[model samples]
Target chain A: MPNSETMAGTSAAHSEAMIGLYDVHKSFGPLEVLKGISFEVPRGGVVALIGPSGSGKSTILRCVNLLETPNAGTIKVGAQTLAFSKRHRLPGDRRLADFRARTGMVFQSFNLFPHKSVIENVMAGPLIVKRMARDEARAIAERLLARVGLAEKAEAAPARLSGGQRQRVAIARAMAMEPDVMLFDEPTSALDPELVAEVLAVIRGLADDNMTMLLATHEMAFARDVADRVVFMRDGVVVEDGPARQVIETPQHPATQAFLAHFHRR
Target chain B: MSGVSYHWDFSFLWGYRTVLLTGLAYTMAYTVGTILLGLVIGLVAGLMRMSRNPFIRGPAFAYIEIFRCTPLLVQIVWFYYAFPILIGIEMSATTAAVLVLSLYTGSFYAEIFRGGILSLELGQWDAARAVGMRQGQLMRHIILPQAVRRMMPPFINQSVIQLKNTSLVSTIAVTDLLYQGMLITAATYRPLEVYTLIAAIYFVVLFPLTALGQYVENRLRYAE
Candidate 1:
């Protein structure tokens, strides 16, 4: 077991947590959002962050990439660790860019570069940030598009795609970056009810591949089925963290129960 | 004919062909030069206007505000007359016209650039940053492509307006189309015919440009 631990450490994102957030605090002027929140996602772990609206779930997801710099906290992603003090400046531009390259994010609205074709959106990160060769980047993009079942849409614009298709393309775009960890901020929340299944299926496939992921989502049933662990947060604090099945079936906190009740009404 | 002239003469224009042609070319050259230089200034000013640093943003704000509030005609006259006097360095009429028009057009374009950028949803910025794109890459790849599409129609409209405004340079005796036309009218003592010909030339030039503007607008139209 000791030998295995060292072996795992050598492999990229093997046993150690790929992401860690400790005592993270965030505020927007007069309003406070995340208050001393802490969590960890082990290599290949799928952690689902479920919470009510304005519960700081999305804010937490944003902080992982420094899109919304935390008011205070320590964050670690992959092998890089960032510590924040009361007056800590944001990481230097070069450092932040490097941190971002290691992490991929999908958004609720897809945010696919609307002007670019489907293949271009997926290839953009590798081509621009990674400075990948055109042919090499194109091949990677083609592979990812095929994986998402959007190979035919490679030449299509994001505006022409349906909601489900757009989100799938967004997923493919993120995956093309070969990030060590992926973040989904309500990836399916913006999709229509009938269209939600397609996006969920892509995410499920990602889970099966053992890709480390942190998702802020409202798909309770999917979370129960796919997540290794569930983190229930409300009012900027974790209410319960446990196995997905246990948390969904038998939540310990009243707030979690109340929140779950709203979802279960359907 | 409708107002006073019972007869219109086309013979006068034949003698002044070279003067008119030269003026037209000068007008076009000045317009193109102003557009290129103005766009550069606008892009830099627009980014500065959005900067978080007050030092950069303040001067940019002042430039946009001052130029926008004053009339283009007044700015041209002031630059032509006062700039050299104040700086103690003389500039030709053509040089002053180009400088004034470039700055004036740039002020309008700064607003166009700023608005196009601000109109993008915050989600796009967040998504781009999440992918770890640097500020420059984000703008070149994500922000500008989308923003430029929105900018094109207005930009075309501005181009048309600026082209017409190029005639203002004639007032400073730059020997542009309108100025040449004025000289022809004074010499011929046939103001009606000369002015009518000038109007026709402007219409002929501007009509095609307006059509091209519309074509660009339709081509770049984004799907909802």
Candidate 2:
């Protein structure tokens, strides 16, 4: 019934959806992580994946950008599509790289290039991957840094920045790629409580600006406030999929209700 | 107990300074040449060692192990005296010295390069790949720049050892600083002064290099 409902939802917004994952299956050795995962993010739509730690939320986000190739499924982002199955060979590195270029991903740990300065980290994708002119890259980097409210720290090293500042810079770095979609894998999980707001504010700003994003987060309150749709995952499968408010407030599935209960109890 | 007191003099060495200088120049030349060649070999071999294919990885592993386990002195001698017989080709002492030293230094450098790269967190690679950079670009732009800072102290330390290892070439009559000292001892009958000056010259050259390594290490540490 969920699959049919997903199909019905897909066709209703097929023209707008920027990301699609169908029957995605993933495994690590003998341990299966994602079993028949399916979801779609319409353009400018914010979809938050919520679940406990081992619930395959992060795996789903990673698969969206081909960071962890699925054992079986089809993943589509923008104009690129990757189909993975036993019979079909995986795409070559060049093709995969080009496909990945279309999407941006922010990690739990802000994996900024510590060796590069803040602006350089922002400019890295455009300068090295896109082969943009130095002046052009600098201008883009400066603009993105300003947008993220870290323009003053452009010349500073990543080590010099606070956790929140680094995460903001990471957002700017990913934004510089001009990705069709952005994937945030617990972007604020590594930050202190005080630091989490600044990063969440930046992400909220992105959502306000209509950036299509798939966020895997434990921040239930933020997810309800910012995400347009919520996909509740448990044990590698989506147990409930509905509007952000409905799923968080009145989850239909017992699994989802139990998961949200822990968050509300806190 | 009665003991014979030997006269100590270094003034004699001042006259033969040019010979010692030329010998010093040769030592430096070999060191620079072999180090460059060894670095190239190390890079290639290090990369090969990381390759998923056992065919590529196996040879690199064998090469690193062979040179690392055996003595550098024996390698130099075997290349100079015994290798030519096996290959059936005439080999010069200079050629043999350079080849053996480069291979020896390369084996160690390969490990340093590989270890430095491997020490980086997997997240760094993920970040680079996420931005759509290929393997080569990630290694060149993102990985190497950081890894090189970690690699500096060990790299310089290895190069310092390579410089000292050059002394082994003297056994094959290569006119390095040590060989020059031996020749000077023969003619002047001043083994003490001649050998002592040779050791002093090596100290002078190497002390600065070691100091430079520490300076770079401290700078990189503060940079982070």
Interface RMSD of each: 1.0, 0.7
Cα lDDT tens digits, model 2, A1-266, are 44445454775333557999988999999999998988899899999999989999999998999889899988989877778998878787888788888899999999999989999999999999999999999999999999999999999989999999999999999999999999999999999999999999999999999999999999999999999999988788877888999999998888888888998999
Question: What DockQ results do all the predictions give, each relative to the true complex?
Answer: 0.69, 0.79
How do the residues B123-208 of candidate 2 rate in per-residue lDDT, one tens digit apiece? 99999999999889999999988888899999999999999999999999999989999999999898988888899999999999
Worst 10 residues of 1 chain B by lDDT: B215-224
Clashes, model 1: 0
Per residue, candidate 1 scores C-alpha lDDT tens digits across A112-170 of 88778999999999999899999999999999999999999999988889999999999
True-vs-predicted CA distance for residue A150, candidate 2, Å:
1.4
Q: State the lDDT at B101 in candidate 2.
A: 90
Prediction 1 TM-score vs. true: 0.93
Q: Chain A only: list TM-scores of all candidates.
A: 0.93, 0.97
Per-residue error (Å), model 1, residue A182:
0.6
Best by lDDT: 2
Steric clash count of candidate 2: 0
Predicted candidate 1 versus true structure: per-residue lDDT over B1-224, tens digit per residue: 56674677889799999999998888888889999999999999999999999999999999999999999889989998998899999888988999999999999899999999999988788777777799898988899888887888899889888888998998889988888989998898888888888889888988988898788787766354
